[model samples]
Each structure stands twice: as C-alpha cells, then as structure tokens.
Target chain A: MIDVGGTEGGVRLRAPRHRVARRAVLWWSCQAASRVVVLLAAVGFGAWWSPFPNRALVIALIVLGVLGIGYVTVMPWWRYRVHRWETTESAVYTAAGWLSREWRVAPMSRIQTVDTARGPLQRALGLSSVTVTTASAAGPLTIDGLERDVAADLAERLTRTTQATPGDAT
Target chain B: MNEFPPEEATAAPTPPPGPFEDWQRLDPKAVVASTALVVAPMFPIVAIMAVSDDGSTRTLTTAGVLLGVVVLTLVGSWLRWYFTRFRVTAERFELREGNISRSFRSIPRERVRSVDLTAPVVHRLLGISVVKIGTGQKAGSEGELKLDAISTARAEELRRLLLRPRAGTTPESATPPVADSAEETGTELARMRPTWYLYSTLTASLLLFTWAAVGSALSTLSDVFRALWAADTATDWLSDTASSVWTHAPLWAVVVAAVVTVLVGGLLGALAFSVEMWWGFRLTREGDATLRVRRGLLTTRAVSLERRRLRGVELAEPMLLRLAGGSRLTAVATGLEHGETSGRSDNKALLPPAPRGVAGRIGALVLERPGTLEDGAPLRAHPRVALRRRLSRVLLPALLLASGLAVAAHQSEVVPWWSWLVPLGTAPPAVVLAWDAYRNLGHGHRDEYLVTRYGTGVKRTVLLQREGIIGWRISQSPLQRLAGLLTVSATTAAGNGYYSVRDAEAEQGLSFAESCVPGLLSPFLEKNSEFTSESVDSLDGTSHERAKKRTDHP
Candidate 1:
C-alpha cells in the first residue's frame, strides 16, 4: 500500500513476513563445523610433523576454534534478520547479503521467468526458495527461506504477472 | 494459428522448394588468399635455415617436407572454399559448410539486423570483400553469419536488400519522410582529423612502456640478438660492443639511454599503426536508419550499425588523452562483439580520438538530436564523506608498509633505514589521485538520458537512456551504512550493463532511481517521515495517492 507518486511524499515499504524454520540454524552450523574440522586437522598435522615449532600451531587452533564457534552460533540469526523480499503488482524487491547488504528492484514487465526450488535439507525442513529472473545484466534475484506452500504460491503469482505484462526486450 | 481452407487442403498444397537449389560458391580467389596467409609464417624460418650454410641432405629433406605441407594446405583450402555455399530466399538466409561433419543454419529475414563489408589490401586489389550478418543475439557465433570473399558490388547490393525495413512490421520502419529522401545518397556524418590521430597514437602507446622495460634487460636483449644474427661471430661482436658501453657508462646512465631508445622506437611503431588503421575513417548515415563507418589504410573495413539498437554513447578519456583535451566515443549497443581481428576495439568506436567539443558534436549527430547528451548542466557531486573514504583507502596501505619497514629495520641489521622512505615518496601522488577521483565523481539526468562521470586513470562519462534501464541495484557496505551512503547501479542490456554512482546518500540515490524510472522504485522506498506514522495509515494514503496520480496522468 505504498504511495506511487504522491506530493505527501515518502512511501513506507512492506518487509517480508515469516522467518525460516528454526532448524535452519542447525543446518548452517553443521556446514560451518565441517570447515572448522578440516582447519583443525591441518593444524594438528603441522604440530606433529614440523620441526621448526608447534607453539604457533596450538595458538592458531585455539583462535580458529573460538572464531568458528562464534560464527556458527551467531551468523544465521543475523542473516535471517537482514534478509527480506516483497512482490507487488508492478515490481519485486529483494534485500540480502551479510557484510554488504544489497537491495534490488526488478519490474514485473522485465521478468523473464519465475521458479521455486527445494533442496533435500529444505525438503526435510519444509522450506523452499524462489528465484525471479529478469532481462538485466545484474543477474537473477533469489529469495530463500519461506514455507514450501508460500514459495509455490508466490512463484505462481509472479508467473501470472509476467505473462500478463508484455515487452521483455533484451 | 490459422489452418488452410478445407477445399484448398483437399486439393493438396504445393510442394515446398528445396533448400539448396539457389546455393552459390564464393570467389575462387578467396582460396588462394587464405592459403597464402596460413603459409606466410613459415618464410622467416626457411630464410634462417637457408642463411645458416646448411646444405646437407637433412636440409633438403626438411625443405621437401615444408613443400609437401604447403601443397596439402592449398588443397585443403580449395576444398573448403568449394564446400562453403549460401542461399538467400524470400523468408530466410541459409549457410551450409564443412567437409566431414557439416553445419546448416537458416536465419529468419526479420531477425537480420545488419550486414558489414570489409576488404584487406589484397582483397581490395582483387575486388573481393568479406560480409558478416548480425542477428542482434547476445551469445557467440550463433548470433553472427559470415561470408568471406565475395565481389564488392554484390556485397553492397546484399547489404541494401537485407537491411531494408519490412512494411508495417516494426515501429522503426516508420521513420520520417525526410530520412527517406536522404536515403538515396547517404550523408557524411564524421571524418578523422590527422592531428587528432597523432595525439591518439601517442596516448595509446602507453602499453609500450612494459615492452621497453623488458627489452632493456641485458639477458633478454642478448637472446634476441643471438636469435636474429644466428652466427657465433656476429653474436660475440654484438655482446662485446654492448658490454664495453655498459662498462664505460654509470649504471643509471645506461638505464636512461635504454629507456630513451625504447620510447623512440615505441612512438614510431604506434604512429605507423594509427596511420594504417585510421587513415581514411568516415561515418555516414544511410536511408535505412543505419550508420556505416569506413576506415583503414591498407585493410579497409566498413561496419553497419542499426540506429534502433544503439542505446547511448560513452566518452572515454584516458588521463594522458584528457590532458591533451582529447576523448574517444564508443557506442553503447547490443550485438557489437569485441572482435580480435581489429587492433583497438575499433568495432565499437564511432568517433576516433578527437577534441572534446568535436566528440560532443558527432555524438549529437549520431543520436539524431542536438543537446541530448551534452546538456551543459552541472552534475551533482557525491557527499564529502566520499572524499574521506577515498583518502583513507589510499593512505591505509602506505601507512601499513611504512610501519612494516620500520619494524623490520629495528629488528634486523640487514634492513636499511632508507628503505622506510619508499612509502613516504609514494604518498603524495596517491593522495593527489584520490582527490582527483573524488572530484570527478558525478551523476545527472536530462530529458531521456542519465549521465554519470567517474574515474581517476581513464575518466568515463556515460550517457544512457532512462528507458533502457531494466532495474536498479542498491548496495552498501557496513562502513557505507554508518555514513548513510550507498552505491546505486543502473542495470540495462547494453555493454556490461552496470553503470554505478558510488558513495551517494541513500535517499538521494533512491530518489534518483525513482525519478528516472518512476513507479518501478517509488513503491519500494521507505521515506524516513513515513515511518513515524502507523504503517496501515501510511500505506493506505500512499496507494490511494498513487492510483489518483495514475488516473490523472492517463
């Protein structure tokens, strides 16, 4: 319900609703754990084989482990708080990224296609993501972490909008 | 879809025409020219061997083998020329080629965008030219069709026929009647100036500095001389003279001498290259709403660009070129591939290196409007925080290096105290560059075009059409967010399609985007004032206002 071009000025944008399932934290943590394990294994092997010194290896392992644990516990929540997406009659707005937040707006008339995808873990969690592709060089806009049914409904609505609007010239 | 009438269908439809009936072969001279080009590289090797006094049976046998290769290549090229053939029907243009595994392609007549004609010195003498047809597609050779070594007259005829607008099919066909009258004989748009060409040659020769530096190294120089002279006596004499000069002169003097020699040689080479490439450059507007550029001294190239496909113009001014008050203009258009055959990305360049004023005039003529791009309005500069960001970026690396060197000097006797001076010596120039870059950053819009200017080394001022932009991307780093700044990129289909205005205030960037494309971004921006009110009230008011505006506009 944002004003399009009012002298009253300034439209308040609607942010996306519905956070991803809480289990998403566990899924991301497991991915982070595998990387930490490889780093620890490398440092342990260096300590056993290198004749120069092992003190640095021990210090490195401790520092890395602390950082990894912090990242695993904290990053997903921060990402979920920042990521947002919304689709209106004329345009789709997507905001994403952790360190450098990026906001993109692609008009419905420019959209080439819309698709919904579900990975194995997402299927287990009953969550899905939708991708909106347009004839732009900035590439496609993807919104992840929605209920499976909601993702399907959004994708269908986007498809209908694109079909009704013509003229996607590249 | 329409079906045939029932009575006509019962009567039986006429059999369709065969695809290959009208296929025609290219001129036979093309086979000879291609074979000669392939064989040209062997001449130097053969000459070296001949001068080395190798008269043994092995030498004879090698010559015999080379002769066999030449014969085989000649036969192969002839076969290829015989196999390649093309046909032009009313609905489509078809090309078929290949000896073992063949490829057949048929492109619809409506999809053909432009046909370009070119001729090298040899081809020009032989009265033959190469033709390429573009279909306005984005990816690789699938978008292009080439026909090499046709009669020049036929190429011109084909170009005219292929580019003629189909009646009532495309809106572009509805050009004004004035253009129709001008179509009988094309009007000259722009021509190269010799003085500007000289400036372009000197500025473009900057790459030669790297080659000169590498060539001055003694080991590489000796290797080159040894290879060229071949005989041991010649190599010894050359090395002895070189070493004697090196011994007599101080090290710095020798370096200076080498640098001077390299610079002179490079300048001469660049001068010759520019003279050959841009000798007779000219741009003309044809009646079919196409721009045709003809240039090159020895190898002539004529490129045809459809006017409708051109998105805008880019003025690129390299630091040295800008100092000389010169800039080059490149067309921002789709289907213009960066081809390797020409040396300077010449396919995209509409105007050669010229004075800034001349470039503006030519750009206006090409766009078919005066004062469209060069509106003379002052551009809005980014916030002062942008300057602070640039300064910090430049100074941080220097500070780190100076500190690292100081620490090393303190810890080790081998580290010299004077080495710490390196970063200090570089800081002044770095600061100047950062300030210059900040000063150059600007963005503005006029009528249908959005103009942005940026760069430190090679300043680029791009004029892009507002309607061409398909979306907007707003990005902000954590630091940028703290400073209330963001970078906005206007995404289009032409060129790389990411034109950015960096370090602008977030609200300013959002408002610019909204104004450029109207409703596309207005609905998404959250005004600071609106957030103070209840969400429902703000939303309802905005939507209703938007609807009212739409109806009023309609």
Candidate 2:
C-alpha cells in the first residue's frame, strides 16, 4: 500500500539485495517512543517526592517530547525500501531499498531452510517475516512485514523448489 | 598456507537404505522413570504437610497430586511420541515432525555430515538403537530427526551409509535399494580414548553443587532441631530422653558428624556419577575424515562429526588436573558458533568429555596436533611492540576515567576523585589483562591451516584452513591511535572465533589473514584453494617491506 521505492521493482540496483526494511522506520520509531515514555515515567515516579524543581523537570520532559514527536513525523520520508520476491527458472530474487538497491538471487538448490515467523503485533496485522537461508552462506535473507498468505506461499514455493532439484547448483 | 587439494567428487555418504522400520512405541517405563525423578524431590515436604498434628492422610490433596502427576506423565509421553518420525528417501534422509506446526526437512545425501548409530545399555539389551543424522547445519537445531528406538540391524546400516569414507560409489549409484544391515567391515577404525578434559570441569562444577547441598542440609537440620527443642512439651521430654541417651552413649555426636559427612560426600559423588554417565559414552574414528561420538544414557545420541568442519581444537589442563597429567580437549565445529544449533537437549554431550591421553588420540584421529603435540616455539610478545603495548594498556583506563569524570562533573554531584577511582582501580587489572592478552596472542600458519592460540586460564587454539576465513576487518580506536596500533579481526564462516593481532604487524597480518580466504566461505564459490605451506612460509621472510618498496618503483 505504501510506496517505498522509486522504481516498481524498488531499489535493487545500488545496495545489497536486502536493505533496511521500509516498515522499520514506523516500527522502530514506535518502539523508541515506547521505550522513552517508559523511561520517563519511571524517572518521574522515582523523583516524585524529591526536592528537585518541577520547572526543570518539565523543561527536560519537553525536550524529549519534541524529539519523539519529530522522529514519528519525519520517519515516513526516510530513504529505505521493501523487497518483492519473484521466482526465476533456477533462483529466487528479492529486491528492495530506495536510494540504494539490492537484488539477491538465491538458487533453488542451495536453499537450506525457509523459516516464517510472525510476532504478536505482526500477527494482529496479518503480517509475517520469512527468512530464506542458503547453505554455506553468510546470513539468511529476511523479508519482513509481508501479508500472511504471501509469506506462506513464498515459503511453500522455496520448499518445493529446494526438494525438486537436489544439488542443482545455480 | 598451502593450497588445499580439491575435494574429490564422489558419492556423498547417506543413511543405508533399509526397510521402513517403525520404532517400537516407547514403553511405559519412561513415564515411571520420569515420575520418580520429578516426584521424589518433593516427597519430604509433601509428607511433612500430610502428617499433620495427629497423622492422617489429607485425602483430597493426595488425590489431586496423584491426578496432576498422571496428567503430566501422559502429556510428556504423547509429546515424545509425536515428535519422533523418520523415513529414508532415494537421495536424502527425510524427517517430518512437530507438535504445534509440523515441519518436513530432508538433507541431500551429499549434505549429510555424518550418520551416527547409538545403542544405550537398555537399547542394546533389546537389540534396538537410535540413528542420528548430523547435517551441515549446527547440531541439535532439529529436535527429533533421530530415528529413535529402531532395531540394531537398521541402526548399523544407517551408520555405515553416513560414516564410511567415500569409495567409488557415484550419486546415481546411491539409489535406495533393498534395505538391510551393512556388511560388517573386518577392519574397525581406531577408537579414541575418552577426552578427560570434561572431567576436570565437571569436578569443579560438582564442588559448587556439593557446597550448596551441604549448606541446605545444615540449615534444614538446624530448623528441625529448633522445632523439636522449642516445643514446650517436647523440650522437657526430649531433654530427659537426651540426658539418658547421652549418659549411655557420649560418642553419639561424633558418630552423627561422621555419618553426616559420609552421607553428604556420598550424595555429592553419586550426583556427579549420574551426570557423567548421562551419555554412557563412545568414541570412534571412521577413516581419518570423521570422528564418531555416541553419548547419552536415556535419549542416546550418536554424532558423526566431519573433521573438515572443525574450526578449532581447545586442549586445556586445569591447575588441579595438571598434577594428574590430565588434559581436556574440545573439538569445535562451525555449529558451535550458533549456541542453539546443537538441537540435543543435553548441551554437554555435543562434545564428549575425555581424559588427556585419550584426547591426544582424538586429536590424532582428526588429524590435529594440539600445541602440546606440536614443536612450535613458545609465543612471546614481539619485543619491539612491548613498550607500546605497555603504554597503551595504561592509557586506556586513564582516559576512560578522565572522560567519565568529565561527563559526571557536568551533570552530577559526584566528585572527580570518585570517578578517578573507577579508572585508578581498573589500571592494575587492565595492565594484568593486557599482559595476559599479549602473552596468549599468537597466529601462525601450519601448512594449509591457519593456527592461532590465545586466552589465559581458558586458553584456546583455533586450527582452520585458510579457506575457512570468510572476511577480515581492520579497526582502530582513539586510544589505539595514540598507541600507533590497529587491530585486525578475521572472521570465518564458523562465526565468532576470530584471529586478531595488534600493534605494528597488523597491516601485514590483516593482508596475510585475508589472503588465506578461499573466496569467502559463504556462497562457497569453488575456486582453486589459493594457499600453500611454501607460500605461507614465504611471508616469514623479514624483508617484506623492503621487498615491497623496491618492487613498487621497479
């Protein structure tokens, strides 16, 4: 629904196949704000009976409040992207990013594992994260915030492809 | 390092094709054993509560507890049964399992690292065993892939397919055929003596547990004594009885103390034996390429580990064990880097514990020579970098504290002296730690292997081929800048264990470490392994800089 990259294929040309997830801005901002609020609440409660000036405390609170507000407001315009996975003849390509793009091609034969996980919040949103692992590789390619059906379909496809071509190196 | 020869293209080992043998359903005995172990610990408290003022069983509570145990036992048994499933496919060993969300995974014949067959004493009596397929993925990640409770003949066949070295069999020829036990090869591979290193660590760990148990026992005894002595009616009666008994037996206290010590010590020793025997162990080598270890008593495990996957071998002799000429050796593979990989519930069994002499035999079987076995010169700090190293060590604490004070002074009521103590107290330990670090640091090429030994009390020596290093990083901190030094860290596919060198030699060391890489271990782009012992030794020539400078302008 949200346009994350410049091209329809997104930004897969400049950066690694998986850049920072586009939804990370919204997710991380929410997380950072929640943490800040909890910290501030604890500090305020702990200092409730202290002789420290309320005026100074108010000023400090205001500063943090403004920063949190600014972050939530400007995060949408951040130069990040989301990846779309497409199956190829021998491999699967994952494309993402905005300013810098990355295209990762994992051949069907080399796929070691396909794991799909959905956090409580993501589950509520009907979204899941799928990580595709290749044997003898540095790290798995993770695509977060995909619709549940899409993630399931992708996982099934990768699994089928892996089984069909045993040791068919791309 | 010299270039490693190409791995010959041959049929990968697999589980021997056999008849679809369904594991005998787990007997009800496991439920009884589980209940005994879990329920016995709570008996004392339950008895105390039940034996009220007059001594009559609380009927309701007793029934409830019994019902709870029965329900727990059933659930445990069912879960155990549900997770165990296995099938032998044409080209892969496939397992389908899971209680919540079922998963089906298969390892291609070539991807199977090792297949291990283990027979627990009980299983052996029943002519049954478990087959463990060690895939390239870290150990234990797959919870129940093991073909558990299978017949002895089936297990042996699986072991042969997974453990035997490559012969002339090709992938096409490896198709599943009529299932049966593999023919017993006349020559059995050499068996390694149990690595005793785990024994010392075990002894140390058990001592702590003994102390805790003794403390708990003393406290409980004191409470019971106080309860009896403090009771008005019991005190007078107990005093009169004690007086009469003591008059007759003055040696009671000493006898009690002796009995307590013996009982406590026996309990401690028994607990240690129970744990040590958990994996009633076995170690065998298949050709030179694989080390087969079978351990665990209840959920018996057998791991056929590939020697090539080993990133490092650590042999340790604790202070106490040093006297007994005992050493412990740990053979670590890439799977070790990911803590959760060893899917086995018993983490300790991933590496079998063995005695020093036996560990040496293991090292030999895996084609590794621990530092103790090697004739390498003892490592020492390069004299030229010693002053810089010493100065650098002192500088870190001083700067850290000074900065801490600067930050504190700006915001807190705390004095700079308090902040300075932070660094001042750290200065000595920092120096000691740095000295220890320098003492333990050494990296050298051992033929095609890149060998590095470091660490103080728990010294570790990593042995990996140059092809193992995936990448290298050069890092410099502000403090390091003052010391005119940089640290180069090398990463291998195995993950965390890195080879780092500091001070003046870092640049050349980083280059040398990188040159060892066979085009990044990941994505495993097959290239001619680009290192040889002769080329590695060539870097040893002292005139490296001079030779480079001359060649640059030539």
Candidate 3:
C-alpha cells in the first residue's frame, strides 16, 4: 500500500529502490567533458592563430571555460545522485535529473515495449540503459547507467510482466 | 495502394473458401470522383488561358500539358477503381490493392475503434462519402483504412457495424463502449446559430489567412514577371520603391496601413471560412454514449467519438475571442487523429467559436456531467512566489530587451528610434499577460474530472476524465526548487497526450497528483522527506548502490 506525506509534515517521493551503476558518474563525466573539451580546444586554437586578440572576449571565454569545466565535473556527479529506478509488482517507477529532477511512474499494464541499449562508450564502461515506452507520446521512461546484464534482466522482466497482461492499456 | 478491381475479376463467380471470396470493388462513382479531383484545380487556369487574346505558344504548351494530365488521370482512376478491393469478415477487415508494388493490410475486427465518414461537396453531389476506419493502433496509421468514394448508405452501415457496442460491454462501465442505436438521426445536443460567425472574425486566423493570400499573390506576380523575361525591370522597380518608401514615410504609417488592410481583408476571409467550416454544425448523442459531430458547408464531416475514447474536452478562448466572451470547444478523444492523410484534425473539433455560455452547456452535455464544468471545484491558486517567477520569466525579458534595444538605437548609426519603441511598447502588455497567466494557473478535481486551467494568450480550461489519465510526471528545475515550485503533467492518450499544471507549489503539486490517482504514487513518496541529496563516495563499487541516504527532518 502507498501513503501520502501531508504538506505540513513535508511531502516527498522516497528514493527509488535502486541507483544506477556507480561508474555511471565517471561515464557521464567523460561524456560531458568530451564535448566541452572540443569546444575549449576550438576557442583556444582560434585565439592562438588570430593576429589581433580581443582581450575582453578572451577573458570572457576564459571565465566561461572555467564554468564549463565546473559543470562537466559537477553535473554528472549530481545526476548520479538523483537518477534512481524501481520496478514493483504493478508499475515501473524512475527518478532522473541534475539541475532539475523528474519522477515518472508508468504502470506495468500501460507499458507497450521494453528495450535495453548500450552504446560503444557505455559498453566500454559496462553500462546500459533500459527504456520503457507507454502509449502516450510524452516520452519513454528510461533508467540509465545500469550494468549491461542488469539492463538485460530488467528488460526481460518488464517484457514478461507486460505480456502477462492482456489488452493494450490505452 | 489504390488497385481494387474485384468486380472486374469476377469472371468466375464460384463460391470461394476464404474471406477473400467476396472482394468488393469501390463504387463506380469513385472513378468519376478521382478524375474530378485531378481536373478541378487546373480547370480554372485552362479556362482563363482559352479566353486569352490570340492563343500564344506558351498558352498552347500549357493547354497540351493539362490535356495530357487529364488523359493520364482518367487512365489512373480506372485502374484504381478496378484494382482496389476490401472485404470485411467476422474476424478481420482486409484491404488488398496496388498493381506494380502490391501490398495487403489486415486489421483484426476486435482492434476496430471508430469509423468516421466525410462527404466533400463533390462527393455529396455524387452521393458518396470517404470512410476512415480508426483502429487506435499505436504503431501509426497502419491500422487506419481510408476508403474513398463509398456510397453514403454503405458508409453509414460500415460506421454502425464497426463501432457497435460489443456484447457484454455496457454503456454504464467506467469507460463505456460505443453507442447503440437510439434514434435514426440521434438526439441533437447542440446546433449552430448564425451569429456564432461573428466570434470567428475576432480570431487572428482571419488576418493570418488574409496576409498569407497577399504574400502568395505578390510571389505569383514576381514569378509571372520572371516567366515573361522582365525580371530585371521588376527587380529594379521593386528596389526603387523599397529605397524611396521607408525613408520618406514614418514606420508607424506602414504598420497602420498593413494592420488596417489585414483587419478588413481578414474580416471577409474569416466570414467566408467560418461559413464553410461551421455552417450546419450539429452535435448529437446516439443512445447513451457515442457523440457524433456533423458540420461543414463545402465539405461535410461526420466524426464519431465513442464514449470510451472520450478522455475529456478543452474549451480554448483566445485573447480576442475571450474578450468577446466566445470560446472554441475541442475533444480530447482517442483514435481520431488522422494527421497522416489530411493535415487538419477534422475529428477533434467539437464546436467553432461560440458564446462561452453555449460552449459550456454543450461541453457538459457531451461529457454527460450534471453541473457547469469549471465551476465544480474551485481550482487551487499557486503560491505568491509563482507570480514572481512569471514576472521574471516573461516581463523581465521584455524589460531587458527594451533597454538593450534603446541602448543599441542610441549608439548605432543604422538603428532607428522605432526599434526601441517596439520592445518598450510591448513591455506593458507583457507584464499584463504575465499576471493574467499567473492568475490562470490552477488545477482541481471536480467529480470524475481533473480540471486544469492555464495559458493567457489562449487561456484553456481542460476537464480531463480522471480515469482517462494513463500516468503522471512531476518535474522540477533547480530554479524551480529554489523558488519552491514544480510542474505536474497528466499524461493521457487523448488531446496533446500530456497537459501540465505548471509552476505550482511543490508540496501541493505532489499532493494533487497523489490524490488524483491514489496508490499510484504513494509507494514512491515519503513523509517528512526533503528532496535534497547528499554525496555518495562509492562510485567505483562493483554492485548497485542507493546513492543518497534518506534524512528525516525532525
């Protein structure tokens, strides 16, 4: 049975049953850093080759570069803290976000498909993401940063649970 | 795939073994309908060309091309009418067509949801209608079947047969099945009044269409000049006017002229379109359930929304229409979106712009609810911080932009004074709009409906059926958290699929979502739980870990 915490007492959703694989922090950091590194390199190269340097623009870019570095390091770490997933007897629940957080619950009956995906980077990190889709076009419920095997198991279990139900919930 | 030549292939009338035994070809008038489709657009151009002084080489060339098109169309229509065959068996509805690249589609009869019929003026003249069978298949339009130019009687028969309430599926269920026959014409719930067209004129679509027409006319004139090999002269003349006009006249003059022209032109355009679209508009309920909306002058549409698929209804009042006390009603129904074949959402629309009182009464009738909709439960207002957030989100940007433009205008040689005036003038309205939007922010549960009202520009109040909601999502940004605000989105299969009560107090939002669909969110929710997080230092762990330690606030 589920219970609601009243506002005066403080309302909240309990952390989902499980967190993503820990190295997901490292994987996501590398992922975020990769793009920022390219951008930083491009700006550095542009400044070095220019005959006339704009001091103001260069200083602004440096400030931005430092902030970008802070973001690349801090964001993944925060995302890891927030992203959690749980599958119950009747529903698949997930919470994910960094600066902003989103908590989504898709009933097992409403689920249309369950898939597991691992990109080359994720594969190298031994990580995979499980995606659960419902009839609504809003989007799929994804639990990212899981061990490949765990993702596969989750997908299998979801498929079985969904198949147990008869009609397309919609 | 248009090849349905079943009657043509009836050389052997022997009893067949499968459902394919009686492959029915399209009605004969379908060929004429197809041919007319090809000829209608070009006929006017050709007529004008034929009357032109001394048929030139270009005229002759155009005429020849059109004649060839007509010949090809006639041949194509005959093949299409001959090859397309559809048969409905007890188990499934199957359609087989195409000659060169053949394809077949079979839809299980159980998957069928609603059958809609449309009769354009041309089809109506020929006593035929277009039949679209909606199966509500999530994998796009594969489950939808469009049969062009079927007899009106057959179209009606198909609708009734396909959408008839199934055995044991009664209308009293939480989500009812389709309606059974109550009356021949059904009981009329609402009829269009002649004066409703006045509100249509208040809509921006009138001006939008008028401006679009002017834009196309200008482009066509330029294209003609290019075709006549007078492009250079036209370009020179255009440049000369462009250079001479703006500098000589105040920018406000041009704006006023353009506005006036669109207003007057749009009035006429709106009146014409309103009549064409909403003339003879009627909403009827058959038996206890299904709602049938019949409307249009040039193109009559009969869209059926089975009660089970009726998730909710939205009453949208655009700024102008709202000022005039008028609102448009649209359905939040499933399996009615036929966006693939026709870009327009013919089925979702329930009523054109009408008086707010009329729209509300009709909405209640359609939903089978007793009291007035929004008046049911007083929607909870957002925390005062929400007003601050909206002001910063909308009015702050406008203020900043106005200041930026003012500085740019003063500093730059090319920038005009009017550049700043535009943003500065818009600032007041932006503030007003922001306040209006804040006031409109609220959600409440009214009996079986979850009502949400938002948007200032359109200001829509949606009375979505609580049972229709498939899921709920609670989203928050860091800024939102700092402001103690969050958004709750109710995800459904109907309408836009998801509608949000944006910028509500975080606790209220969660509690609201929890109460609407009890037990769905409780296991995930914790009492005295703050959403803040603590750092976990075991990132290199071999097994899964719960990242944050839940802290209880004393």
The top-ranked prediction according to TM-score is 3
Consecutive 10-residue window with the lowest summed lDDT within model 3 chain B: B545-554
Candidate 1 stretches with Cα past 4 Å from truth are A4-48, A115-129, A145-153, B1-21, B168-185, B204-206, B209-230, B338-344, B532-554
lDDT of 3 at B9: 51
- State the lDDT at B175 in candidate 3: 19
Best by the lDDT measure: 3
- Report the lDDT tens digits of candidate 3 across residue range B1-554: 33433453533433232313256777789888888888987775666556552646988887789899989988888887767788766567788777777778888766777788888878999999999888776555675788886788767756765565554332223112223234356889888898998987777665576668777977876665565453576588988997688778899997898788767777887788778888898998876657888888989988887888888899989999999999988888767663333446557878878899888988988888875565575898888898888788876677788788888989997888678777667777778988999999888888888889999988999988888777778899888989988899988776677888898887788888878777677767766544432322333232232221121111
All candidates' TM-scores? 0.85, 0.55, 0.86
Q: Write the per-residue lDDT of candidate 3 for residues A71-118, one digit (tens) a residue.
A: 898999899889888777767788998887998988777888998888
By DockQ, the best candidate is 3
Better of 1 and 3 by DockQ: 3
Full candidate order by DockQ, most accurate first: 3, 1, 2
The interface root-mean-square deviations, each candidate in sequence, come to 7.0, 22.2, 6.1
Docking class of 2: incorrect
Tens digits of per-residue lDDT for model 2 on B405-492?
Answer: 8777767776644565666666776677567656666666665666666554445455555555433434455455454455545544
